[model samples]
Target: MEKNKQPKLINPAELFDPGPYGFSHSIAVESPSTMCFISGQSGGVGENHVLADDFKTQVQDALKNLHIVLQSHSMTFENIVKITLLIVDHNQEKLEIWAEEARNVWKSSFLPTSTLIPVSQLALPGMLFEIDAIAVKQLAN
Candidate 1:
């Protein structure tokens, strides 16, 4: 699979621009491709697996962890086709923070397809935010 291959991002003209919401309406992946499914990553780190007390901090750490996994496979944010975000206490303020962080990572390019879920709690006690992704790379014949 080639690292440079990117999925086609689509956003209908009739629908409102989703960039501010931190996602695209859909992404089209070409055939003969390999997909990497990453499990949900949270802010907890180190041997003790401690989560940050602040929501924004946890969001930042979670993204850093996601980047680590992507780099392991030689993929970047542009290669990501889909992502699912889980927020412990989803709100407008937190949404804004998450969107800002996402924009910082993706820049001006079309963002990946995303689904944000508001959850009462996460797998870990102190965890406040989690993100998982699906990335694609074209396979050579």
Candidate 2:
């Protein structure tokens, strides 16, 4: 999948604002393809066994990790159908940073539906951000 692949973005006019706030109301996926689920990816630096301290960097690290998993199946960010974000030490500033990074990653194109969760802690100490995603790609005949 290309980073700019066309995926359905569902945000009804009647619904509350989502895009302006860095998320879509929902993402609709057309099936008949292989599905992939990535486990929660944190900001841990691979092979270094350490997590990034800053919120923005941590968010980017998680996305990079997610990209690695998606690429293994020939998919890209556009292949993502849904995402769940876990943020430790949740706050407006942290959310703003996360949203900004998300907008940067997707640009103005469609975005996968996302769920944000505020938590007191994560699977590992010092993990500030984590993300898990679901993706799908059409099977070649």
Candidate 3:
């Protein structure tokens, strides 16, 4: 009689449903090969670091900071699986405008799972928004 052989198991991240809200509940849940957690990235650095006081400039700077953190770990925006955004003032118009900027940066790639939280203010008085993210590197077979 020949012995029976078992197949190997494979696991990958999966997004959960968020019901009729039209958005997913969870982003991904898989045993990550490597996980990276980026700190909340703000628009400016030092007291005199304020570049562009406008919303568009702040958005651009935040994205640039995100890229810097990703680059430090040999990754890019495409590798990001989830993101959390904190906005100082919550408005549909502002969100729409910010979406445009985000689209310009992300391009045609699939948008990462995200959450936008409206807040009264940030740690810094002049700060308008802050963004944070989580990413995982898929292992090669």
Candidate 4:
């Protein structure tokens, strides 16, 4: 990969396309790059850490929070190579909502590879979803 080359998202011909499910099969990134591992972000808003009751709202807020963290590092969603989602009491409806929300955020055909884990609970109460990401930015030198 050349300098400033974005990571390559690979969805093998044999494997099914995961974009509709909010992920990719794999991502390949070359070195001479900076990799940022963002911590889990919940749907909490403001200094008080208020959480939304609904899953969809929580997913949206969590994505926004993740973007804020990425922005702090001078990066954006395009830099993301992988993500992990933790959903409380996850179900079909929740999956659909996640897929919709993810498609809304990621517009390109290539998307970050992701793993979704269904959990019984989270660190904060009323937290329905949490997302963590690994982003890579190629260096100029």
TM-scores for the candidates: 0.75, 0.74, 0.71, 0.77
Measured over all alpha carbons after superposition, the RMSD of each candidate to the real structure, in angstroms, is 11.9, 12.7, 11.8, 11.6
Write down the worst ten-residue block by lDDT for model 3.
7-16
The prediction achieving the highest lDDT against the true structure is: 4
lDDT of 4 by residue, 2-119 (tens): 7676765544343333466576534545577777776677787765667888999989988887777776666789999899999999999999999999999899987999999999
**Tens digit of lDDT per residue, candidate 2, span 3-110?**
454455544343334445466433434445767766677776655546777888889988877676666666788888899999998999998999898887787577
Candidate 3 has an lDDT of 0.66
Instruction: Tell me the RMSD of model 3 versus the true structure.
Output: 11.8
Candidate 3 TM-score over all chains jointly: 0.71
TM-score of 2: 0.74
Model 1, 1-141: lDDT tens digits are 345567556443433354765765345455687566766777866445578999999999888777766765567888888999999889999999998999989985768999999999997788999898898877789
Clashes of each: 0, 0, 0, 0
lDDT of each: 0.77, 0.74, 0.66, 0.79
Which scores greater on TM-score, model 1 or model 4?
4
Query: What is the TM-score of candidate 1?
Result: 0.75
Worst 10 residues of 4 by lDDT: 9-18
Candidate 3 Cα misplacement greater than 4 A, ranges? 1-32, 45-51
